[model samples]
Target: MIRYIKNIFLGIYCLLQGMYISMLNMIRPKVTEKYPENRGRKEMMERFRGLLTMPHNEQNEHKCTACGICMINCPNGTIQVISRKEPDEATGKEKRVLDRHLYDLGSCTFCALCTIACPQDAIAWSPVFEHTVFTRNKLVKQLNREGSKLEVKTGKS
Candidate 1:
């Protein structure tokens, strides 16, 4: 009979303790995100590897030399470079022309492997992290700008 009374007191003590904690939590300040409030520059860091961008000149022509090294180094085959082989009459050899430079941002790991592998130092990270698109086709970016052949020098002169 005495042991039963002790257990009953212990259960009441535990119940009172839980109620006290719950009452304290109800009075205390609520910690929750306020989406309507502007956080200004104190925003959360966006986690993404991001896609590569070709460095352009004043006229927006890419610095790429149409080298196949970037294409070979890409682990996911995200980059597809199409070069036009133009035959030079004087040199008796075919010279490469930058026809198309396609980049699939979705498949890219952004390991910067392609950037490092490039001898021409063409590709770079452009600070453009927000690349949200409804369709997968929109994610594929073309490096070439129409009608401009302006050159971009990467390394020191």
Candidate 2:
């Protein structure tokens, strides 16, 4: 009879302990965020990786020399580099120039493998994260702007 009474008190103690923990958690502040609303730039974290982007400078020029290093390192074949040789007007010599840089965001896992493997630093992650699209064709994008050419980076500052 005494052992049975002890077990009942033990069970009640356990139940009260669980209820105390629940009450503590219920009184704490909520941490849920309201997404899809760009309230402010302060809401974005510093290390948040979004879309892979190729930055073209103000002159509409890029650093990619069509080396195909990014395409080779991509795990899902997301990057495609197209190039053509054109005679340089200044030197009368043939130079390989980038015709297109096809980036398929649909197949891309955003592992940043292509950007990390690029020798010319041609690719990077952009902070803009609103990538909702209706069609798959819209996901496949040409990184380089139309008429934009590769700029030769001189060692001289």
lDDT by candidate, in order shown = 0.78, 0.86
Residue 121 lDDT (model 1): 80
lDDT of 1 at 82: 86
Which is the leading candidate under lDDT? 2
lDDT of 1 by residue, 1-157 (tens): 9999999999999999999999999999996757547444334435334558777777767667787899999999999998888776668898787888899998988888888898878787665556789999998998777764427445884
- Candidate 2 per-residue lDDT, tens place, 1-157, comes to 9999999999999999999999999999998776746455435565566877789999899988899999999988989899999999889999899999999888988888788888888888876677779999999999899999887677972
Candidate 1 clashes: the total is 0
Q: Please give the lDDT score for candidate 1.
A: 0.78
The 10 consecutive residues of candidate 2 with the worst lDDT sum are 38-47
Report clash pairs, candidate 2: none
Weakest lDDT window of 10 consecutive positions for candidate 1:
39-48
User: How much does candidate 1 score in TM-score?
Assistant: 0.62
Residue 96's lDDT within candidate 1 is 80
Model 1 CA deviation exceeding 4 Å by range = 1-49, 87-93, 150-157
